[model samples]
Target: MSALQIFVLALVQGITEFLPISSSAHLVLVPVLFGWADQGPLMDVAVHTGTLLAVLVYFRKDTVGLLLAALGSIGIVPARRAVAGSVYGKLFWALVIATLPVVIAGFWLSASGLHAVLRSPQIIAGTSILFGVLLWLADRYGPRVKALDAMALKPALLIGLAQILALIPGTSRAGITMTAGLALGFGRQEAARFSMLLAIPTLIAAGTLAGAEIAASEDTMLWRDALTGAGLSFLAALGAIHGLMRWLSHAGMTPFVLYRIALGLVLIIFFWTGSS
Candidate 1:
């Protein structure tokens, strides 16, 4: 893509990736709606990579504390038997449980026939509306359950399974997972934070696998282009991550839900009119 297109896409990816709005949908629709060239896989990786770095940096203190608590004291008690209620221990197990379903399901989708069908706008509109409504209902009625660390194992897995819905083109991993948390009665901030933390391992696995594929490809020019795109995406993503976390913590997801509904309705209308 051209430099301007790349910059816009990077900015869009950065802001929307962490927000409750569907980053995948924005990424997909932006190019198609505006007739821009494909942002391609490399740029896609860069955007998420940037966001990932933002999350890591923003939560570094929590991460370090968790690691220390998990590893236990240097001169003190048993490391392996470190406090189970500790932030690190809890977050560690929670992340593991939350990541399991997506790992299997996402890899399966990538390898399966569903991969071929992933480009459909109809499916995007449908899933977007469906999950968007789900998020609304969740925020409306789900319980006031414990924050991420306090959640039960089974619930975390259930939310993770919900995350698998994002494997589809427009379903949006962050949107789906946050909805799941809301459905389980998590407060907006807590649900969003855990959703982000869980994304750490999940996205790394995805990026690594995709990067490996790129590396194995024979086209050297393609690799170079992909690297440039990925770099841009990463830089933009960092800003997105910072903004989303700050905004969501204070504002909840009502605005995003409204945007999803509007976007879905417009797409559905366009698809319907195409036949008439």
Candidate 2:
């Protein structure tokens, strides 16, 4: 890949990974749209690693709290006295409940080989528009009475189940999860916060699986490109997270919904014209 390809792909990954927009869709479409070679699983792992780092750094306080809470639950310390453990402990368990569904679903999809089969432009266009509408509806009508700290097992589990849809390219893990959050009465920013936090484990699992695939393949892992992608994506992801959090404070998901719709329409047109 050229420097420009690396930079563009990394930027797209970093920005869309967090936004309600689908990062996978953009990554797939960008290369096809530009007539560039597919950026193999190695690069996917690399950019995902960068976004994973961005989440850890941005949510360091929550990360530390969750860590202490987990340790406390494991008897490494008194649960009551551990930093933020009293509440974060419950949150820790809630996140666990939320992560299980997708992990299982993802494994099943990969094993069935449907994961690769679902990566077409038609699927992307349909999901991008469909889920974008879901987001808009959830935002427009859903009550915003809950905060992140108030999260419970049921809601978290529901959100996790919704995340299974993210296995489909344009369904968007962040978007679907946040849509579920909104529908469940979480405030917009609160929904986004939890969505991002939830991404930590999901991304780790994804990166690990992708890394393993690369390791098993005969294809050489280009460390230089990986590092460049990771570095650029890290910076872009951090900025995206910060900007998105700030934006959600004042606005709803309307802008993102519109963008997704527009993107989907454009993709539809492109594919239709190409086929004709």
Candidate 3:
């Protein structure tokens, strides 16, 4: 990939990964729109790794608390009763339970090769518009009383189930999970925060799988390109995460919904015209 292609793909990944807009859709669309080749799995792994780092940095305090909370629960760190009994401890379990559905689903899809079959522009357009509407409805009508402190098993499971849809090209993991959070009456910031935290495990699962593929493949991937993409994506993702959290503090998901709908419609037109 040229520098321009690397820069554009990295920028798109960083910005859209955490938003209610579908990052996977954007990544798929951008290449087709520009007539560029697929950025390949190595690039996917790199950009995702970068965003993972951004989430870890932005939520550093929560990440540490959750880590301690997990250890406390497992009796790894003895006499940490207070941490074990706190909300973070509960949240750690909530996250674990929440991550299970998607992991199973992803593995199934990979084994069946159905994941590749679902990567077309038509699928993306349909999912983007459909889920975008869902987000709008959830944000407009769902009660916003609960915060992260209120996270529990039921809500976490519901949100995790919703995340399974994210395996579809345009059904964004962040978007669907946030929609579930809002529909469950969590506030916008709270929903976004949990969605991001949930991404930690999801990204790890994805990156690990991608890494294994790259390692086993005969094709040589350019480490230079991967590193460049990772570095640029990291900076872009950090800024995007910061911007999203600040935006949610005072606003809602309306703008992102509009963007998703518009992008979906545009992709639909592009798909039809190209097919004709």
Candidate 4:
């Protein structure tokens, strides 16, 4: 990829990763659009790292608290195993545990030759539209559950399970998880916040996987591009997260729903025209 392509993909990664817009979809589509996606593992690493750092910085205090709590809670005890061992610790570990589904699935797919779907534009478009509609309905008619203080284990678990859908490229992580949270009685803003919190571990795992692969790569020039992309993504991701929270807190999911629908339709149109 050229410097311009790296830069644009970085911008897209930052902007799309946090929003209910699918970053993976954009990473694929945007590169395809500009014909810039001769992307290597390093480029993927850059995107993942940028988004990961964004979450880490945004939630630094929360991560610190969780680490402290988890460290303190560590001991040979069965009761505590069900718990993070403390408030922050439990939530942190819950996020980690919840991330297991995606990790297992992603790693499995990596090893099992199922990663081919990552390149499928049709699957991406279909998932984008389907989940887009689901998000719209979720915002429109969800039960509007209470906040985290009132949250129970079952609801959290269910939401985590729902997040598993995001392993598909077009299923936005934020969109699906928040929709699941809303289904379980979380208010829009609360659901949104929980979804962001959930991003912590997921990003960490993604970064780790992408990072490992990138580290093993032989191309230094791609690493330079990856670094540049990571930097841009980090910068953009912060603003994206802030804006998404602010919008969802007061406005709900209408903006994201409309955006998704528009994007999906445009993709479909592009495909139709090309085929003809």
Candidate 5:
């Protein structure tokens, strides 16, 4: 890919990855809309790696606490009652539970080849609109009183199930999970925060799979392009995460929901016009 294409695509991946907007839809549609060639899987892996690193770095303290708590839970370290009752231990298991459904569904869908078939603009447009409405409803009407400390087994599993919908290109892993979190009464920042933390494992798994494919392929991996994509995406994602968390404290999900709706409508119009 050209440097311009690399930069734009990486920026899109970074900004949308953690947003309520569907990154997959933008990744697919950006190339088509701009008449650029497909970015291919290696680039996808690289940009995803960047977002992974961004989230890890942004939440380094939480990551460390969770890791230590997990080790403590497994008896690898001394388990403190205080730590056990804190956000770290509860969130560690919550993420593990919330990550399970998507991992399993992703494997099944990939094996079935249904995953590829669902990548069309038509499906993306439909999902974007549908889930956008769901997000709005959850945000507007659902109780927004609970904090991350209230995260528990049932809600985490429900969010995981919602995450499975993200297997559809425009359903948006972050969007759907945040929707579930909102519906479960989590405060806006808390919901967004947990959604981002949950992305760590999901992104790592996806990057690893894509990396394996690159390793096995005969196609030349452009190290320069990959590194550029990674760095640019990391910077963009860090800003996106910070800005989003800050915004959520003052505003709600209305802005993001409207964006999703507008984007979905535009895609629908584009597809309909092209087909006609």
Candidate 6:
């Protein structure tokens, strides 16, 4: 990949990974729209690793608390009452439970090869528009009384189930999970925060699988590209995450919702015209 291609793809991954816009869709569309070759699994893993690092660093405090709490839960270390009783403890469990649905769904999709089959532009266009509308409805009418601390098993499971829909190209993981959070009454920032936290495990699982593939292939060019993509994506993702959290407090999801809808419609039109 050229430097420009690397930069552009990295930027897209970083920005869209955390945003309600589907990063996978953008990744797919970018190559198609620009006539660039597919980024391949190695590059995909690299950028994902970068974003994973960004979220881990951005939420380091929370990550540590959750880690300690997790250890306590398993009796790896002595259980601290304070840790056990804290929001972090509950959040740790919530994240674990929320992660299960996607893990199972991803396995099934991969095993069935449905993940590859659903990567068409038409699928992306339909899902992008459909979920964008769902996001708008949830944001507009859903109650906003709940905070992340209020996350419970049932709601977290619901959000996880929503995340399974994200396996479809345009049904964004962040978007669908946030929609679930909003519908469950979480404030915008709270919903965004949990969605991000939830991404930790999901990204890790994906990156690991991608890493294994890269190791087996031993592609030197892919390694170089992956390294470049990872560094650039990390920087971009950090900025995106910070900006998003700040913006959500003052402005809601309107801008992102509009963007998703517009992008989807454009894709639909482009594909329809080309086919005709």
Worst 10 residues of 5 by lDDT: 76-85
Q: The CA-based lDDT of model 6 is what?
A: 0.90
lDDT of the candidates, in the order given: 0.74, 0.90, 0.88, 0.76, 0.88, 0.90
Q: Which scores better on lDDT, 5 or 6?
A: 6
Per-model TM values vs. the true structure: 0.85, 0.94, 0.94, 0.88, 0.94, 0.95
lDDT of 6 by residue, 113-180 (tens): 98888988999998999999999999999898998889999999999999999999999999999999
Which of candidates 1 and 5 reaches a greater lDDT?
5
Rate residue 122 of model 6 by lDDT. Answer: 90
Tell me the tens digit of each residue's lDDT in model 4 across 1-276: 677887888888898887888888887787678776457555766776888788778878766666565555666354345444346655655666666677677777779877665656677778888998998888888878586665556677777778878878888888898888777777887787778778877667667776676689888875677778889999999888888877876788877888888887887888866788
lDDT score of residue 21 within candidate 4: 80
Give the per-residue lDDT of model 5 (tens digit) for 16-61.
9999988888888888889988787678878988999999999998
Please say which candidate is ahead in TM-score: 4 or 5. 5
List RMSD in Å for every model shown. Answer: 3.4, 2.1, 1.9, 3.3, 1.9, 1.5
Q: Would you give me the overall lDDT of model 5? A: 0.88
Q: Candidate 4: list runs displaced more than 4 Å.
A: 76-86, 213-219
| Residue ranges of candidate 3 with Cα displaced over 4 Å | 78-82, 210-221
lDDT of 1 by residue, 100-211 (tens): 9988997788788686577666777888788888888888787746576677788789988888888786777888888888888788888888888877886676578667
**Who is ahead in lDDT, 4 or 6?**
6
Q: Residue 110's C-alpha lDDT in candidate 1?
A: 74
With a 3 Å backbone cut-off (N, CA, C), the pairs that clash in candidate 4 are 84-90, 145-185, 145-186
lDDT of 6 at 245: 96
* Model 1 ranges with Cα > 4 A deviation: 65-85, 213-231
